[model samples]
Target: MLLKKNEIVEIEITGMTAEGSGVGRVEGIAVFVPGAAAGDRLKVRILKTAKTYAFGKIEEILEPSPERIESDCPCSEQCGGCAFRHITYAEELRAKENRVRDAIERIGGLQNPDIHPIVGAEHADGYRNKAQIPIGQDKQGNLIAGFYANHSHRIVQCDCCALQPKPFEQALDAFLEWARKSGESAYDETTHKGKLRHLYLRMAEGTGEVMVCMVVNGNGLKGEDSLAALLRERVDGLKSVLINSNREDTNVVLGRRFRTVWGQDFLTDRMCGLQFRISPLSFYQVNHAQAQRLYALAGEYAGLTGKETVLDLYCGTGTIGLSMAGRAGRVIGVEAVAQAVENARENAALNNIENAEFLCMDAAEAAQLLVQRGEHPDVVVLDPPRKGCAPELIRTVADMAPSRIVYVSCDPATLARDLKLFRELGYAAGLITPVDLFPRTKHVETVVCLSRKNPDDRIEIDLDLDELDITSAESKATYEEIKDYILKNYNLKVSSLYISQVKRKLGLEVGTNYNLPKSENTQVPQCPPEKETAITEALKHFSMVPFK
Candidate 1:
């Protein structure tokens, strides 16, 4: 049962990988087939083989899976944009949820991750609010616009993708018409001699405002006016047309320089009951409606109270931080992008959120800066990029001693890795929620709630006592009870700090400010011999410890 190249074999797909590849076993050897649906029995041609696994291509469908569907997009196989287009949405969600579960349990080493069922979007069609289609030309020099092939820079021409809104299709069509007449050559990556490189698009799902930005190699488009006029005529609610100049040869889609050729330079979108201005490079979620649900869940897991200071790292346009500003006493947002930080500050002002402030700095630097400024955040919200937060940043934030950490991640593997690190640093994560913000694609969003472990290794849950039926009372003897027991039984008084220091000496977790001095000038008195003897006797009297 060794899998060889071009060898055809029949197998039944039983599961899917996180990358949306169907997995089937042949004599105990796993074959990974892309564009395959689970429960499908198919004849697969082995393309590549390894020691324990192999790569395959679907040769013939012996029996189609019950979850299979006819793909609406013609280029769904070639384009890497959507992986689940050929499968039913329900089945797709199952795969994504399983992916999260596997990552948290298998990779994260958590026995009970407490994973909730994934929250699927209401509808999958045309949910993307933004798109960046690379610009290319056919052999006949006809301009083409579509996504790049999977794992390659070669363009796969798709006039209308199902994931994008109608405005994108209209704008793309208009660009092709104008560029065909104006003779603007597509950027050749090899020679780097052309002007047009990528067609960037953003739409305000709430306001229905559309923005079209042409990413180019040189200064600007030669016939930008005609292009703008054509876009305005074809695309409804055309709000802006601009150019991003990236003269250097790089893989980055948007450039540093931007110039508006028509209309305004930005588009505004509404999310979580707040207005946000979206620039070309703003880190806004692509799915607008689903984003509201995602943010609401993140906020709920954060468990913010009015007396707590909240820190939001990688606060893209301050969306999550601004949403929780009302519930939190003070909100501080930190981001690396200057433009996004500007938008975040403006968003706060636009929403009249006086309690929130935004800073433009890297997350690790901002965390250290906040620590230096004596800002103690009770809750910290982290929404990092796909690569997840750096280990140093996680340690710095944990050092801030936030009571709760809400981690929203796009990559499950990295999220699991970070959660393991947090556990080692005394934060235990529970109740991870997977969200399908990007339907019909392999991408899934997950939010995990981690709480600092107490002395008994129990999580400190911030909630109403009646709601949770739980209190912050220690399991063992209360500090006041211990003090009274010593004073009454042995006729000696003891301070709570001294008792806490004893607990620390016995390897118990001493909470914040228990036995530590307030400042450098503050002196703490040590427990006298008589007080220590009385405390040890009280410990036995109260059945707290067995002492001779």
Candidate 2:
């Protein structure tokens, strides 16, 4: 049927697009409806009709899919923060995994590739580590702190959000009161005026320390001391307070104007048992618990030995590199962000970790320096940003020829491309694990492990072993049985099992943090019902490989 603009058409959603659009097809033409997802039969009014595609707004969900959930946020459809809030948690994970796989298959030109299931978040809600709220006043003249609307720069007041902790909302309220008492005016986007512009809040996971930055338009603070004191008293977890004055007309970020007025300039947090100090603009994982798991997977893929030295390229605040420092002899983290480097140093000092170091430099430059210094790292872990690593850095890593290369990426297409390049340079792609650090969003984090290629290492053997009575077993049996047990239970090949068993025996526990109890007999905790099936599906697809 030929659909016209403003025509009401009911279509079954088949998939989700990267820009958070729900996709359907009608009469062999692609129809995209906003706020629609797979399995949903929605009644949408066509907004625009193009030659090959049509855009529509969902009038009603004629028949909601089983995978749909009642969104907890009041402004779910309007707020741009959560793109998948209407979809069930399981469906969200599936969509994200599919997005990565599809991107890899389509963009990277990889077919029939073994892709691991995505490791999901244990606590989906209140998992965000940072929250940025724009200071705006509604038409009725009430100050609001939340996010912008879907397609507009105008801020929408979000009272209850599933992503942020309860304290954040309270802190927002407290900040508003403080602003009123201080006579601070909210920034007006239309007129380009006002004193207060934005409130950036970041909380440390393990320490619960908070850093709040107030972006202002002018230098003179009318009630700086009083407002700071009030925030410290009212906000229970606040550790750092900063005022960043942006006097320029352009919308550039506040980088240098930050002045610390309270406890510390940065806050500390732990991921994969490694400590890090996060400054105002430092890049840390928004979801803390999931990050621990994500980092652990990266370390495991790196296959680090106690004697191995690691180069953590694009290591923002040294989160991944610092976490793996206990296992690696020395960790050199290089990031382009200077503030992040300072935070990384503070984090190392706070944790009393001496073997880790951080430097502020471009990743490609750092890699080149390593080459110039005649230093080759045994393991090279690259956790580049969404833009991915530069071609030069990739080439440098290939030339250096590390024993193991761990590539942690937020984008899968880039990761697959890098892995393909590494494969061309005599490195075999080992294990690729997808992690869902952000629930109810299209974003997915991936960890890819690559090992140096050796033509002579071709013997393949299974290491599965049944549970044995360690008390009665001899020394040889204990070792052999334990190795086989890990292989059998974990379903890995001999070499992989051997390395994992050795790490465990040597008390080097690496990988994502599972909140296992301190008690020896405690069982692994269970995920929420909505997320369990997705995790099980992911685990089924998870496997190790040996490339010849």
Candidate 3:
């Protein structure tokens, strides 16, 4: 059946995507329904339809799933921040754990990946330590401030957000009050005019300190002292208030110049028993409690002794490295951002840590330079961004021949891709832990331990296939495994013939006289391009080798 716009149809939700959208099937076409729970029988009206899939809006919940919950946020429907607000917390954890597992097995090509249980947050609500609320104006030209709608710049007026602390609410209210009183013009993204663009807020969970930075179009805001007083009155433990001028016509939030109008330029915060001075450019973990949990797990995986040197890559403000300084003999941190490197050094000095050092350099370049300097680190820790570590960086780290590698990643897909590279470089990732640092959101943090495989761990074997009378190329993965991989990942079913054909095309020895048509006029359905690509990727994932 062809799905049309405004067509009402009943569909049963079978699964969910990583973006927190429930996936259902109508006449075999997958329909993505937002605000839907897994196992829901929903009456959905098709909003838009594509060739293979369609987007639908829930007309009515005919049957709710066990994972479904009553959303407490009034703006949950518009603001896509709290992705899993409609689902139970337990279910959300389940989905995240499954997501990591799927990434490792399907994407990382690791069979039977040892993934531990997700570390759930104790307080799901009010967990965000950082908030960037966009400032806007209503259609009537009234001052409005809130989060943007899903995939849109339209500000949805929200009095409060469940993900932010109560203090953030007070600070936002105070800012709005000041904005109205000062007649501050809300910035327009389309026009790129007006003064106030955004209200950036940060908190120190350990020290109970807060920093409020107003992102504006110009260098200054009118009546800065008055705005600071208003925020300080409502927000408890207010430490700093500053203005960040972002005059460019880009969607990027922060600008090039930052000037302190009131208070200190940076805010001091404590994490893992170490104090850190957080500037506007410093890359600090937004989720404070869950971040501690993640760092602890990464430290455990590092398995550092008191006498071994540890290298922390992408060391933002030296949080992880400083936390492990007391355990290791010496901690060396490397970061590309200059300001973050300065913060890292400051954090080390603030904690009276004399054995740790921070270097400002790219992760790949730093590893190469350290090799040239004849410095060997016992353990290497990586906490790369969403794009993950560079391939050359992984190779350089492997060249250093560290005993262990602890990797912390925000994107599972990239992490898995890098893990595959590590396997090729003689390093093997063992147990992986996925932590729900961003609860009620689709994003999850993962930490994996990759150890240098010892010679004793491998059993040397030389096989003579001719002696066994087998005249076929041996594949690392079986046909059934490849078929299952394609089915689960792309939701497409493939036959053994297609897999063999793809392997043969790649110069792999498929076997003598295998998958050959008996007659010249035999009608064999060729594998489509999509299925062939999937099969080829599956072959690569399984470590299949081509005939030399």
Give the per-residue lDDT of model 1 (tens digit) for 1-548: 67889999999999998889899999999999998999999999999998799999999999999999999889999997788998999999999999998998888899977999999999899999999989998878778988899999989999999999999999999888888888788899999899889999999999999999999999987778878888999998899999889888889888899999999999988888889999888899999998999999989998976878999999989999999999999999999999999999999999999999989999999997776554668999999999998999998887667889999999999999999999877789977999999999999999999998754442222222122221243346666787777766665445665665565554445455453333444334455556566666665666656556
TM-score of 1: 0.85
Clashing pairs in 3: none
Write model 3 residue lDDT over 1-548, tens digit each, in one string.
77999999999998888888999898889999999989999999999998889999999999999889999999998999888999999999998898888988898899998888989999999989999999998989999989989998899999799999888898999999999989779888888889999999998888888889999999898899898888878899888888999999988999878887767778888777778898888899999889899989988998877988999999989999999999999999999889999999988888899999999999999998777554679999999999998899998898677889999999899999999999877788898999998999889999999997644432112122223322244535667777788878766666666766787788777655454444554444456677788888787777785323
- Backbone clashes for every candidate come to 0, 5, 0
The ten-residue window of minimal lDDT in model 2 covers 539-548
Question: Candidate 1: worst 10 consecutive residues by lDDT?
Answer: 462-471
How big is the positional error of residue 280 in model 1, measured in Å on the Cα after superposition?
A: 1.0
User: What's the lDDT for all of these models?
Assistant: 0.86, 0.74, 0.86
- TM-score per prediction, in order, is 0.85, 0.79, 0.82
RMSD of each: 9.8, 15.7, 14.0
